[model samples]
Target chain A: MKPKLVIPLLIGIAFLLSACAGVGFRSDTSWPGLTSDGDTIYMAFNQAVYAINASNGNLRWSYPAEPERDRTYFAPPAVAEDGTLYVGDFTNGIVALNASTGAIEWGPIQLGEGDGRIVGGSTVTGDLLLVPSGDGRLYARDASDGSAVWTFPAEFNEPLEHPIWSAPVVDGERVFFTSMDHNVYAVDLAQGGQLWATRDLGGAIADSPVVVDSKVLAGTFGNELVALDADRGRKAWIFDAGDWIWGSPAVRDGVAYFGDLAGELHAVDIRSGSEIESWKQSLDSRISASLAISEDRIFVAAESGILFARELSTNEEQWKVPSRGTFDGDLHTDPLVLGDTVIVATNGGDPLLCAFDVENGSERWSFTPGGSDKRCRSG
Target chain B: MNIGEIWDILILNPMINALLYIYDFLGPTLGLAGAFGLAIIVFTILIKVISLPLTIKQQHSTQRTQALQKDPEFLKIQKKYKGDRQKLQEEQMKLYKKKGINPLAGCLPVLISFPIIFGLYGAIIRSLADSPSPLLEFSKHIYSSVSSTIIPLDSQFLWMDLGQPERFPIPALESIPIIGDGIPILAIIVVITSYLQTKLTTPPQPGSQGAGMSQMMGIYMPLLIGYFAYTFAAGLALYFVVSNLFAIGQAVLMNRFKSEPEPAGKKKKKAEEQPKESGVLSLLASTQESMMKLLGIPPKSTTQGSNSSESAKDQSEQSGKKKADAKGS
Candidate 1:
């Protein structure tokens, strides 16, 4: 590495790998996913779902993600265009967040301990949701209000394998979901009809599937890239990375990108499953955080407390920015980049929500949910 | 139970109340009970005492190794044969035999302490469960069996509930902004004081490799810990600030008493460096050179000169007076 080139290279690599590097949030209570509908940005916390202004990071409103009495809340909240936010909680059913206000419009959709995945962000399509759950059922919940639209029973009965591993992917009118049971489902959005299901991709599919055109691209704990046809629910192409792929894959244009536990990020063509660009950057640790994608850029957040931003086209380094603390050991949040500011969250230390100026990689503002030292004094 | 009573059962119970009670049976004046700085002070003292014998052993082993390899000829042989593993091992054993240096002395205590900390953690969890510990089956009884419910075993000095110190009233504090409640000023003071505490206690280590190792800890460790202290329970932060101060005091005392060897000709180098500084005010003129090193850089201003430049104006006056005297003479 040349003297001038090393820092730039490290900076670029760090950004892609930095997002997943937080230690666990202050408690099991944390908002793991942040998503928006242009004007409103919704974050799921331990017991509440917070809505912030997308432009200024201001508090628009906060809705409770969990039951009123129970402490459990959804880790991620999903936003739908019809002004409904689909949120999950461990104890209560998934509640619908009013798009304008951070208020739950109806009683939450309750999940049994078997249905607790009612707390993660699910892909929303019209009135249907292919909801992944901890109880092993991937439910199709009504997006309008908290209603049990339908649920696909798992092939197996084991609890761990049954729990929802990651959020589902929606391609066209079909929804795709992967689970710990090592299965992927492609169900029709309108009728909750099972088009096809593929589960033999080897390891668990904790990494949510990313949809590119007609194919759903998913990485497996099995360390293999399994692509399922959105129309058929059959195998499209599988690229084996020879390491555990714990995080979700990102799809932009026709390239699907993701890294394995072995720390190799791959950019593969969605059509043929052929590797387009493969870049290896060693952070000397494991990565389980999901990959976030913009139109031209791909960002992977690592558990090493570093975020690596890479140019999607070239797979080249762009910038690496570090946070003030370690993200939770498990990287649960997926950051969304809006223009120059990338709104990201870490569960470790005190910082909860941080907006980074994408151009200079400086923090625009830090929004902490009251667990930092700065908040300790009467200040 | 109030926060103090809870903390008393958790952290204070096992370490302070229990330890003091045991010590009391041994003596008449166990005056170490119920002090503000007691927990941080005593635990640090225990760590120092426990590590002393190992520290002495490490010192002797290093000294002995130096003594055996004192001969330049043998050292030259080892350097010459550095690539040969067999030769290195032979040289190492020969030195060990000659100097009686145990190869594995330094790692023994650390390896043993891991289990001790683990056990203590288990005990802390059990105590904090508001239940009895499994190990010292009686520690449950110790908090329960011991008569007295004055502090609720969880009282804290301020907003902190010492018993359950992890959860402070951080949400409430940040809610009260500086403009409205005048708490942000206090928060700023706390951050600065603890940051200063972190800065003073943690000396700068060397090299990027050292920095890499220190990336998660060492210098950054104190800051990270201080950060948690600032945000976490006040009792823990109070414990940490007092602890660092105690550690600094102990380090200073130990350094004065032990006088660890510096560069062999350090005095000569200081004499050499002073002459080199005589002409170069540029090196010390900037604020970058004057301000103390911190984890994050201070707000930078290119226009401001360092204090050394301000002092340079004063020194020039004395020099000018001397020049006048020389001209008069």
Candidate 2:
């Protein structure tokens, strides 16, 4: 070929390669959004959503059959009582699939005028599915037909300045959501009107606000865990976490347990916004995922791919498991504990899902979509 | 530190903080709706201004190289050492040294520019963190100077989401089957501006080696950049468009002010030889010539001009020979 032609052809090939490798505006690195419906676990990863048998970690079915370019699934699949799975994609598309068969029941419905992306999972509230979008609007869609029922702020023109990257939590008649705009909002679930929005909390909230004891507990990037009046959206109190908290606190009883990006885990009394003494522990890596609580233990997954289970009563490390091999295994998703098996999803790992015995952190099963020899082992 | 860490420290982190700071100031203080986009524009302009000296040096170096390529002595040296690569390089270096030109001077700014550009691209992507993991990673790169309130920079600017590839949806055009979804307006603009910048900066020399390379660049650069604009985030595309426009303006201004003046005799001769076309027709013809030139297609008028210059050279040579003969007699 001519030299001139060769250079352009080379560039064209590079672009093709980069596109094929998913090198775009956003880096293709995210923890799998894992959820369980008791019998089965549904995982939304990079390109497709997979339904695995909760018992043996065997793949039951994957949606779309073939992964579509530009369509990535990251939000956890929200399974309804009737076994209908509602999920959202990075492309602002929401779809309802039959959980048993992985068949699309409704939509691939494009939301937010094809601009906003669905980063957070949808919450199924009776007949309404509340979806927090990257466009900063909490869309309440009809759970049956996927039709738009109402949008938060009610007014179509006014949206929160920043994206809502966390799911909305429903507390009775109101839906509470934390925004990257540094404000937590309470919207009337039925009318989708804003009841109240909290004053700027000094940082962006990237996780769902946990409601316990009539208080909305949220961790912020401002290095503080803030509790607000769940009924009125007023600031209750703030406990400095000393670092940015990326994950929501897993509340058990009146104590809220959470981890910060600085790798410190704290058990705080949600009522007084005071740190529970002797309940703090530090990990080698950052804790970017929400903690999972079982009957006697709380499972914490760190960014270093280490999963540590601590006894709930004494906050002592029960067992620690490190993801095997050199697989860019980073745990940034909240682990789900079902029965005796505690399942953890990894970011950029060979085994997308790893299950361990809740008692001793023994490997139960490892599931990688393409099949891998690696296993999670106790260190 | 690893390469990734080094990159983060040297380029990515600083850029992210810069963008965040700018967004925070512009959005709240100025009350700009598309504050993030404005921040990117301002950032790009600031970078261009900071690197102005380097850019000007590169431009001067390029002009010098072009002038050298046209020099008769340089052409003779090249022909003499056509079969001897090492000798040709040595002679070229000697001539370059004599002319006080650094052949690699033009490449220095370009090499420096690439990192800054890629860093900005990284910054744009990192700053507009849409998902949890990326957002988590982004938080680590934030400097203490940037306020925590500006954690999530608004990615929306006008109709474009700065995070995604840009496309403009025309409702009226939506009925037109193929392009119903949206048109990549930014990508199209990128291509046009890229082509224009490449063409305007490259001195047109038809049939020359430099011309062939320049022509190839003119074709390839736009397509390459256009593809990126179409594929990557709208913010990066916006950067490309703004950067290309800035470069073109700089080149045009430099050409206007720093171009070498023609001799009075030649200028007079050129004026006398000009075709007396009517006003409107001449204006239209001139526009057509300019368009052709901008597209890197040597205009017919320019070819005629080249012919006139060659004739003038021949006449001058003949006159000098005659004077030498008269002195000999």
Candidate 3:
């Protein structure tokens, strides 16, 4: 070995190692994932699930109710018919909590050798709980006992790296879901068997598919909104966007309202798969949160923390509300429309729960969960 | 397109896609932790193998330059053109041209391989993103086939969280003295292996000018990598350890091929000609010399008026007798 060889190699290795070191400097806070049932809002932030009052945005009780590193929540909590809230953890497996009391109902269920972490929230149909995991399979578990009912890749395909990321959308007897594996899968809800799979859409589908009318609509990394026949798993039509479509489309009447990764809000004719001429407006930022529709107004939040309220009929901008604080921008959770108020959660750097009036987009109340002061603050 | 966009499409995107494909194929049986860890080793080896021709050329050029430095006449030439750097460079180039050897050939290949290695480091960080925005950017770069196969790669390998720095296995372990839970085991391994690899591969510079600098780098490189390993994810530290060991093995095999075995009598004669020193002191000196060379520092001069001249004479010869006399004085 020569001194010449050693010098250059060391420099190269040093560069490589330095690049690896950058991973540690990243912030620990994660984007918020929220879901609401009636007057209670379930918010998953950092590592815990918080149950907040929907009306004034106040904390009710948080599951675990304390910071714990051994477990972490990545997906928004899903509420079941029996008042059980289901959520996925980044380290620990799926758990069922009492939605009313914030108490553990079933688990830290070890899905696969106590190693699997769920990426999407659980979709409960009847007694079955479908959880999409980083393990490249969707585990169908008994909702009551947290026992495995079935798995998508029963034999486990080692070559296919496709891990389900989107939550499974249940329609009638079939459950439709999209995966990084590039295809939309239609599985039988009762049997947990593959019913039909759409052709690869040339991109990864990270958001859950929405079944609108007779079609299943999904956004993709390919920068297209694809609509497939719900029954046959055939492509109905596709709407091309300027950038990758990450947010799931919200359907109202015959039009689908969604925002792309480019932050442009678009309204498309669901039947014809054409962009509505008057309903397109550029928001000038990236949008990863799904749209929330309430009556004639459609609410959407951007990653920059700007919340927009637009008219459903003309796509006219109704009112714009900036993020609450310097720390309260970078919203990732979908805006939740509860009666006359619209609620949106923030994960820019700080964790905040804010509510605004639907008519004028005025700040009604803002709550910072886990704070000593749990009451809503005036704007 | 902007510079950032161009870089994304060219270096970053390709590397990310390649890594994803490798992870996908290996992940099923190995699990994600095993798959990614193994994939890095394979990718590194692949890069080495692909650049073997260039490496060989670089090796040849360096060896040729070193061999020319040994020429007694080359030393005389340096002594003659001591002060005039321009004439010294001219003479050296003339000599290289006559000998048909390229001094820069060695550097070009290493330079060429740099971007690939750099791009690979970025790809690993971006691809293994545990958050939303980076993942979104990662998604855009991946090919449909590779993207579809793997998303949200499992970062758990053994007890290590590949996405986080390696620490004590449990909180209870922190109570232990000295080697507490805060000590990063993988980082320690990385530092040790890097030091060993550098020590094993560094050829003695002996009287060369860069010897001291090389010795310093031997110590510095390991510490630098150790710091990175301690700070970054365990996955990267794992990559460093494996890559260093592999490099050590490659260096051994390459050196074996480069140098032929001498007869016992010749070896004895060569050993007898070497200067004698106490075993421990000589060993320590040799270690320092190795570090100096690793950092590209030149050694101090022992011969009168001929100290910096050796590096200069490797390029060319003096113009006339007048220039030679001036250098001689």
Candidate 4:
């Protein structure tokens, strides 16, 4: 190629490829709901909450937690020990409601100074909910009351201009999170103190960290699985994949599993940090949402709104949950796991948080929230 | 200033005025004063024809510089002076001098066209949308106030006005069907024609530039023109369509007469067939001329030669082509 022409052509190809590469691939990955606390099902579809008994595929109680007309929820609710539900809203702030009565606890912990949505739900370590903030800060709220405790402001650490987009993880006293800075940081959960950060995490970390064998495993935008020692925050190992790894990690036994934006399910050994097995799923869109894995099956939500399931051992096709035809607010409201029953929030049309029978992906019941002024009145 | 206001001054006003001027020039010729279709065509053709020299210069320069695309010595210099940008540029200039090529010659024509483009834009803004300023109003008035002895600009052309596209008015619906829609059938047609024109005129900028920018430009420029047509008056859109078609015609015309080099070894056989009596005659009378100084006589006048055969060839070939051509004549 002529240098004059090649110079521009290479530049253009590199630019286009980088842009497209940054955007994760999509296949048949769906997370109808995410797993929280290994049990208690917490799903959000415009703030409707359905408690499905984890042991049985039965709906315990469902309440339509009122949401602002302009706002929507992007992820599932974080459950407190006292049954206080903390969830992020698209237009407003972090909301705390009584889990049982679905009653409002206090004002939603509004993020930032401007008009921006709380992009993702909070992750709780203690009374502090260490949630990723779109305002570019990790916020800690009082677990008892929906009050701000402290904030860990985001910082630039990457040579390239990649931004932080994933959920944060807490390991021991240190909190591990990924940023556009291209580093995985282990910060003190209490004071936002930097314990240790890997300089080369290779792309943004949109996925929340998964702790297994005292090692932090998280997927990055570069489609790599990075394992770091939980206490010291040293790099354990790295596994590069086909595309971006935006979805959060799911750990089972000694095997750590995560889905990439490329719609491929990867199972890596926690000890060696090597790919034990990999399965490709033909998803229509990228899996930006987290993966909800049970003992035998893993559920992934493709950006195309289709919920895909596969047997973990055999990597065989399970069942798929179809999304509503219109208006998908956000699909990564992690599936709620209540033993044998799974509750998921549905996007499109009138949004609702629906419960499904675990053994077979069947709709148990649904609770739609929004367009109401009444705050939950709990006794 | 805000972006909208900046666009209004630079892009909007100029484009409007150009259309309005063209409308006056071709309006009566085609018959309709308000429809303005004929004015648009004439103006478009005029703009393309006027920019012919620039386009040709750009194309010729691009072709001449093709040999510089993958020069090994160029690559060596680029590598040797990788970090030193100034030195790299100096080396590049030296290389261009050696090959008798201008690096910027290709881009200069395109860059020169930007000013005319700005004028056309000014014409588009003032006349079509009727949001006139001192500059645009001055232009419109100046065009209108021409002498009777000179060519008078008019708005009437055929069944349509030079200022307007074909608009179907539904009395029950509203005053005009396309007033607020921001896109009309005529505008879409113009945008599509402009896009095709761009594709035809633009040297296929090698596939490496990614379809993103070019593809984006292809799609986006049309979409942008369409959007403007909907928001602005029809006169500007008509101008765009006319200008694009003119470009297409110009490209075909210019390319048809372009020069090419002969195939290898064909000239050597001819040289052997009609051998010149003298070495100089052989060099000039035939196409055996290699060195630039081979044609220049008076060996004492010429300073130096570099090739192994340069000194011998220069002395022997100095005084021969006249008798050779005379014999042929």
TM-score each candidate.
0.48, 0.86, 0.67, 0.45
* Candidate 2: pairs in clash: none
Clashes per candidate, residues 3 or more apart or on different chains: 66, 0, 28, 74
Candidate 1 is graded, for docking, as: incorrect
Backbone clashes (count) for model 1: 66
Cα shift from native, residue A1, model 3 (Å): 27
lDDT of 2 by residue, B202-293 (tens): 76665676566667877887988898899878988899899988987776556544624455777677667876667667545544544564
Task: Provide the TM-score of the second chain in candidate 1.
Answer: 0.46
Assess each model's interface with DockQ, reporting 2 decimals per model. Answer: 0.01, 0.30, 0.12, 0.02
Candidate 4 residue-wise lDDT, A62-110, digit = tens: 5444434555555556776767777776544777777765577876667
Q: Candidate 3, residue A169: CA error in Å? A: 1.5
Which runs in model 4 stand beyond 4 Å of their true positions?
A1-42, A46-69, A114-116, A145-148, A154-164, A278-286, A303-306, A319-333, A349-354, A366-379, B1-329
* Candidate 3 CAPRI-style tier: incorrect
- By lDDT, the better pick of 1 and 4 is 4
In candidate 1, which residue ranges exceed 4 Å CA deviation? A1-31, A65-69, A112-115, A154-161, A277-280, A323-332, A371-379, B1-329
lDDT, ranked from best to worst: 2, 3, 4, 1
Q: Is the docking of candidate 2 incorrect, acceptable, medium or high quality?
A: acceptable
Residue B146 CA displacement from its true place in model 1, Å: 49
Q: How much is the lDDT of residue A144 in candidate 2?
A: 94
